[model samples]
Target: MFIKGVKILFVVLLFYLMTSTSTTPLEAYEETSPARRLHKAHALCTLNKSPPATDDNDNEQIVETFIRCMATKMGLWTDKDGYNAKQVAKFFNKHNYENEVMTIVDYCNHQHQQTNLDLWAYESYRCATEGRIGAWLEEYYMLSLKL
Candidate 1:
């Protein structure tokens, strides 16, 4: 009976955590912390390194074309170059995902205005870390095509 009560308590706590997840990284951090946000981004990027989703008209022919398509998922889906990783990376950098992460980290260290609900978006700025995001995405898409 004691074990059953503990199990029920654990389930209730887990549900609260999941439902309480913030809509933004900062908001999430406000409830949690910046370290958690970074960990989340890092996890997301790493997970994305796997194969991507497929479209209806996709062909199983050339590997390069398919790979490029998957790599472009992080893109705005409106570029003329189609699946250009360079352009996508540029867009984020110029706009600000990395900056958002840095800002969060800054707040985490300095205790400034900390909230994932800031006006800016992490996806707004392209990644500025040596093509890390783009490369990971490209590689993942390529692998996905093979299987």
Candidate 2:
């Protein structure tokens, strides 16, 4: 009975945490100190350096690589770039349509009080590889600003 009660309590707590709408992403991020964020980023960067499994799409690997690249470019961490930030930036600039990348970068910077560097970097890579970054950025900008 005690074990069952504990399991039930755990499930309830998990549900509450998942369903709680009171905390925004920005607020949740702000609740952690900058040092903590840096530590987490460092750990993630280190852990994600290995290649993913053969069957996986490696989306998370891509995100992690982009995060590390952003950290390097921002001087938040000193690590070698397997994924080059300058090369990504050049690609983005070369392929961007009608300054949409500039607009998105500027808007994200204003919203984040920083460049939203990681997200922009990820989006740039996604755009280059997958196309339709402009539409995705527009939707993301609208939703994020609305929040």
Best by lDDT: 2
Tens digits of per-residue lDDT for model 1, 9-41:
343233234323434444445433323433344
What is the per-residue lDDT of model 2 for residues 1-147, given as tens digits with 9 covering 90 to 100? 344334333432332333243244434555445423434444455454556535323534444354545355334333322233343233245355436544444343344332444444443333332234434434433543455
TM-score of every candidate: 0.20, 0.26
lDDT of each: 0.33, 0.40
Model 2: lDDT equals 0.40
List runs of model 1 lying over 4 Å from the truth: 1-119, 128-130
Instruction: Compare the candidates by TM-score and give the number of the best one.
Output: 2
TM-score of 2: 0.26
